[model samples]
Target: MVFADGTERPCGGLLVPVTLHQRTGLAAQLGAALAAPTPLTAEGLATPKMPGETSVRGLFVAGDATGQMPSVANVIASGSTTASAIVGRLTGAT
Candidate 1:
């Protein structure tokens, strides 16, 4: 981490220097962050918005960052649902 002054902050963690990172590395692992005020709308008279589909194609998110319930259960459910969706898409499952 760099402060405004250009000094590097200590990136210390329990196992940061080894396998198994310090904390949840969703952002670092995903390499992208999707944010929108609400589900994206299509430009038309009546368009359906595919839930969980992010502005970035092939990339999606859920839970707090996705403006959904921030509860632990919600987070788990969202992740599971998104994962399942991705798998279905890959496997061409209806």
Candidate 2:
């Protein structure tokens, strides 16, 4: 259905019909729609984080936004870390 370049194959009669009962595992199950929360900030996307914060304050990023690891567990960790950073910044503890 997809190529390494990230383009769709246009079906080309290659698509298969699968039912919920027949499917299994992560790929078999329905996946949540995911996308970057926002475009690159003024700092743009250099690495792990935005400039310091995005153009919007109180907003932070984790997971895919950093363009690093893309595993579910890694994203969860990133979110936890980002949340802590935000809390600290808000409470003047950072």
Candidate 3:
């Protein structure tokens, strides 16, 4: 395994399927650090506001950045939703 300190380790006979989950990544840590209103979804994923926004104004979140399921569809949806919100605000459309 390679670490952040540029250290590596060698292992043999590694026959395991490891699935990366959101709870084990930096998203949760960042959200907590920023004191954002991240709520756990029914699927156990930590998600920000439904419109892909955070408690702090102008601070938006989406997809994996918000501890959501790591999937292409989720990312696209989150991004689109967030982007629309931002555009609406910028264009003064409510």
Candidate 4:
């Protein structure tokens, strides 16, 4: 996690460092790259799509990129849920 002073704390998994700038930057970059919309909240944070799926087919968002709570538990859960969906699609198992 990124503190207000710009110091970062390391976390587990493939989660990126949680910071407003990084998260917003990721949202913008991914949205532009995928030609998908990254809906933002009033605070300019990216709004989460619950399942971490985007309008772009085969594109998914999870962890800090979702702009949900920047907690390790939440990030892990989001990644797990999104991964399950992706695996289901790949294996033709719902």
* Model 2 per-residue lDDT tens digits across residues 2-46: 889999766657544321121222311223222233322211122
Predicted candidate 1: what Cα RMSD to the true structure?
Answer: 12.7
Candidate 2 error regions (>4 Å): 1-44, 47-57
Clashes in model 2: which pairs? none
Q: Which candidate is the best by TM-score?
A: 4
**Which prediction has more favorable lDDT, 1 or 3?**
3
Q: State the lDDT of candidate 4 residue by residue for 1-94, as single tens digits.
A: 7889999999675643433434345545556233222332222323234375665556677676565665789889989998987887689775
Q: Which ten residues in a row have the lowest lDDT in candidate 4?
A: 34-43
In order of TM-score, best first, we have 4, 3, 1, 2
Pick the lDDT winner: 4
Backbone clash numbers for all candidates listed: 0, 0, 0, 0
Clash pairs of candidate 1? none
TM-score, per-candidate, Cα-based: 0.44, 0.42, 0.48, 0.51
Q: lDDT score of model 3? A: 0.57
| Total clashes in model 3, counting residue pairs 3 or more apart in sequence or in different chains | 0
| lDDT for model 2 | 0.47
Candidate 3 stretches greater than 4 Å from native: 1-50
Q: In model 1, which regions exceed 4 Å deviation?
A: 1-49
Worst 10 residues of 2 by lDDT: 19-28
